[model samples]
Target: MTDHPLRYDINLSILFTELPLLERPAAAAAAGFTAVEFWWPFDAAVPDGSDVDRFAAAVEDAGVQLVGLNFYAGDMPGGDRGLVSWPARSAEFRANIGVALALGARLGCRAFNALYGNRVDDATPEQQDELAAENLALAAKAAAEQGAVVLLEPVSGAPRYPLRTAADVVAVMDGVERDAGADNLRLLFDLYHLTVNGDDIPAAIDAYASRTGHVQIADAPGRHEPGTGNIDIDGHLAALADAGYSGWVGLEYKPSGSSTDSLDWLPRARRSSS
Candidate 1:
């Protein structure tokens, strides 16, 4: 296996679905990961306090760092990606800010991903974009208060979702930074989605790595673990390192079989921190 210079973290939400949510951090630890990230682990816009406490405890007990998290994206299993751009759901998104920041502070997490909402039938693209910028600015301000950065990602295969290119997300990031006067907003550069969208992977790393807050990976054509499909994971990772990005590369791929069985591509040296 090639030596990857970047630090790595598993996305508990995607890779360890076979385990209970509270049990995933330990599973990741047992698998040799010292850091982990995940999508919002709640089904509702606001989860119960006890659930939050339990999650915090689970990570603490597992001795893994909570390196990144997503702000409340509603009903992920039901196909809702995020709420930041929905004008009607603006309050819901705002309500999640304090909770998210508190959790981030407790976990020493510095990266938060805020997915841009899909275009709504009742709202014009202009309206949606305007609403998204407003919410992102608010999120950026809140994240800054906690010394954390808010991230924007361009997802593929979701046509209704407006930001589908690195350029698209960077434009939104610029708007938010200008509006908020805060530099806490950055890109969540996921190579799998970009590859699926037919983006120039190497070019993207060169163009946006400096401004990227986090990076995620899965192989194209199947969104499975690396080496199971056609993405140059090593090349992009090398490019990111060359570009001076030292953030975590999140393992956000689905396993072809058991999740543990699919980790052969990750060299043991890259699995845990020194």
Candidate 2:
């Protein structure tokens, strides 16, 4: 990749799992990255304020910008995609937004990823969709207090999860915006997930580039770094650039080998946009 056009941020959660959470930020900085993102940093939805302070310190001490963060989505290691639509855990999800935003605000981050959880035995599809809309709307409004936006994405590999296509997420965003009268909701253009769901990447970017608030990537067959799979990662990035998406492109893929070694495809000079 000759002078990659996009401003790329390392996903601290996935890329540096070998290190402790607090250490990942510095590792990313050592790798020449100026920015990073993560899933919820704590197991608890609302971590203690001291813990929140520590989380903020780690990022600040590392000298890297925290560009994105996910609201708690339940036990991620246990296969829970999210709790945004789970009726049982709705309260937990809502309570975490303020803490997430405050922590994010400390790091100058405004884009938040809200995963749509797997289908729960307690709620029907209709009921789940309804709750999702309400929670998303609520989240959007909360993020708005600080001029942030809530990002919704469709993921693959979870058979029970509902939002598996770009269109599905877009529809939910549409409903949330129209019904709840919120405008801070936007699509998370994660090309790897869309490709796994068999969506046309070019068409998706063409249709929703301007509506996209964030972008993430990995390759299919195996969710590894680019060039290890068949997905045209660079070409898709080019297309995104052509479509005028001049935002952070998150490196959210599992490393093909050691995390540091996996970043070979991306030049160090291009790692830090500044």
Candidate 3:
């Protein structure tokens, strides 16, 4: 509702994964998003460069930007299924980072969200942090070369991830920066998770806005579009803008009903006026 400078990105996952992956970006652009993020275009069996190139072309033809990419999930082939639980999976995780970096480079995206897989029962909290930090450090180094940033999002209630608190997220970034000599690494602040996990959203952003590179939002109850449930959507947007965040805010929520039914929120003017 406030006059914020930040813009939002539509993810194909929320809009058109039900359609063929190739048509997802085009559908998103037609829905009025100027920018779109994707989970993994690499999953498509198109030729080496063709997969990303076609997707990038679709984004451009549809008059949108590819702003964010989600590249790291633990299930990457031959890679460890859980980074937090299996510290030794760093090698495969590095390969996953490489794939994401290449995709970012090809798609002209500035950020990639790499998820630290589920927690391992064999590791201590301290050990998980150390392993995550080490793995992230390696990722940051690779991302830096592509002129992109890698962000770690804390899954507070999901103990499978190492970053559960703002402090924990920041600590991981700090560790990567210190160990890899790259301060460009950052945290991806998901407001839904933050609020659900009992974090003071606005206050946390004010404190660590500089370290936060991207944001995602969803209503608390159903993880649906803003205003669908009881999350202060307007207030959250204002807080993010006030904190000097100038990047794309991801609408990483499920549409409660039909995906297109949520188009009423697309026009920024309407969203702000609401």
Candidate 4:
């Protein structure tokens, strides 16, 4: 088996809602984790509880790395409703990307996740793809300046968004690389969504692994943990290895029981070398 790094998103967004951000890393370490992640840290500010400096200190104290940061949600005040697809919201999207990069820097994270939010009815598929490519190219140029890369995730079942296939992501990346002249732009392949969108997970991974900088997982039907649902997660991991993937596989799933209770499967997942 090829060597691969195993970094999970302690997903503090759901795991420790009761605990403060500065305290989540310690909690994750106590659970036998050496890395932690969250969805967004927009609210983190200076001289306060949610400050990223405090979070950085916490991670250093615990000797854990901040593996990933997903900045997908755009519901904040004055924020854009959707990124990439909306022409009117391009400025807002750029500003958000800047914030995400700064936060990643503070938390010692090198990766930031961008979303292809809902598509627009007025825009054709070609138009949406073009817009997404341009936005990602711009973001990539800025992020590369900061020593970070933007990982785009495609979500289906949502109307108006552009990315749905591995091809779409590839096209976007190609456009970004060509326009921005930077090869740091990449994709974040979520196995659960690939299953939902009817992609052959292993085949898709093999095809796009070189461009995939990060991954997320959950089971089908309910999007729960690996063993509790129907996804062939072990096989997926093996495929990831075969495809030459060497990044973190984030546990971005929801828990059926309490987060701690569902963590029983963590050891098995961590132990599996696939």
Candidate 5:
């Protein structure tokens, strides 16, 4: 067994993109990961029921646990990171919660990430923040019913998108809890984003571990697999373990070559633990 205490899960959305979405889980399983996570699988917030069934079947067939998932961010690759804060898109976000919850229930996923929407030309920052707080509060309640927690991630590389620091996300989480009267909302401590935004990683872990609901990692400067970039993956992970974060560390990196080629950082022994 590896010395590290954090369990690892592959992020099928960023890695394994060479294959079809439904085919990626089995591909991850074949590559030795026993748990996986993904962004919303459908282009639209509320996809057809048949689409959901097929996706569900794929995960069940792959035999991997779905440990984490994102609430529908508008167009991930096309520059729309999320819509939870957008006034015009709030309906689309609300429509996605039931679908996300059902899939989470099916996969026994307890972590649901809610990306804060970018600032819109038509809406003031206060308007978006208010909308986001209200929508996320609703999401927290829905996720709570499923015994899950809602996550807020501070993204880098998107300037208009607010919440780029650990403090920013936790503040939002606290506001969400206060507004909803539910404690199911927490921060998603993504190391890659934290590093990109220039936050001290170990300091972030020390400050936010208890309030963090989920964690994702990719090395800095390239968003590639661990050890390929400058981050001290081992040291930071040890810090997380020391801080009592016995949760899944999502491998949310882009593979330099084939997705399987990125397994060098993950030990063979630890890859198959569900």
Candidate 6:
């Protein structure tokens, strides 16, 4: 595939599973990635400071720039999408803001993916949305202080996830951006999820690429590498570049086999954000 006008970063959270968390950065670097991103490194929103320090040191030693991170999303394996809207987890989410920002700041990460919480049995859609807006406002403000942007993404395979379309996410962003008072809040623009949810990728890019803070790729039919499915990954990325999206394209897909082996499709020459 020809190179698109974009930077590339590996999502260590998904790509280097065989290794322990602390080891993933070096593994990515060995695989030719100079930049990486992750979901929360710890299962809990707040881990011991020592654990945090060790993770930071690991990335530092590996010499990979941490580009993007997610705010604490509770029990991802159990299907919880995020904590930004759940009333019960509001305190946890708020508490996580400081920890997330501090880590991102130290790593010089400019993008923070804030997964909107799922629909809870106890809260109505309106109530949950209201809470999400408030919480996102808080995150956006804090992220701005560190010169980073808080990203809201529409996720698929998440039945309870409220943001399933680009429109769904932008509806909320309209309010958050107005409140943020700067460009600190933006859409994540995951191509696979939007395609899975039936949004026209080209139209979505035409509408939202200018507002997108970050981008992720995974082919549809299966969330694997670009050529493993029917999605025209390269064309879409080229369109995004044409539409004014100039940011990291995070490789957030699940591998069909060994993570390193899954990367045979990506040339080492195109791995960095040069």
Better of 1 and 3 by lDDT: 1
User: Who is ahead in TM-score, 4 or 5?
Assistant: 5
| Residue runs of model 5 more than 4 Å from their true location after superposition | 1-3
Give the per-residue lDDT of model 1 (tens digit) for 220-256: 7899998888788888888898899989999999899
Give the local distance difference test score of model 4.
0.71
On the 0 to 100 scale, the lDDT of residue 261 in model 4 is 74
List where candidate 4 sits over 4 angstroms from the true fold: 1-7, 18-22, 43-63, 76-82, 121-127, 268-274
| lDDT of the candidates, in the order given | 0.89, 0.90, 0.71, 0.71, 0.89, 0.90
Q: List the candidates' TM-scores in order.
A: 0.98, 0.98, 0.86, 0.83, 0.97, 0.97
By the TM-score metric, which is better: model 2 or model 3? 2
Each prediction's RMSD over C-alphas, in Å, is 1.0, 1.0, 3.7, 4.0, 1.2, 1.1
State which candidate has the highest lDDT: 2
> What does candidate 6's lDDT look like per residue over 1-274, in tens digits?
7357788899988888989889999999999989999998887888899999999999999999999999999999999999998988988999999999999988888888889989999989888888888899998888888788899999999898989999889889997667655457789999899999999889999998888999999988899988999988899999999988888999999999999999989998888666
Q: What is candidate 2's lDDT per residue for 1-274, written digit by digit as tens?
A: 6334789999999998999999999999999999999999898999888888888999999999988999999999899999999999999999998889888888999899999888988789899999988899888998999999899999998999998888888998999888989998888999899999999888898998888999998988799998889988888888888898888999999998999999999889889979
TM match of model 5 to true structure: 0.97
Q: Across residues 102-214, which tens digit of lDDT does each residue of candidate 5 receive?
A: 98999899999988889999999998999999999899899888789999999999989989999999888888777779798888989899989988888889888998888
- Tens digit of per-residue lDDT, candidate 3, span 71-177: 64554444432453356565656667766676678668889777777666777767866777777777777877878888777774454554666777787677667
As for candidate 1, its clashing pairs are: none
Total backbone collisions for each predicted model: 0, 1, 1, 4, 0, 0
The C-alpha stretches of model 6 lying farther than 4 A from their native spots are 179-182
Report the C-alpha displacement of residue 229, candidate 2, in angstroms. Answer: 0.4
RMSD of 3: 3.7
Worst 10 residues of 5 by lDDT: 1-10
Clashing pairs in 5: none
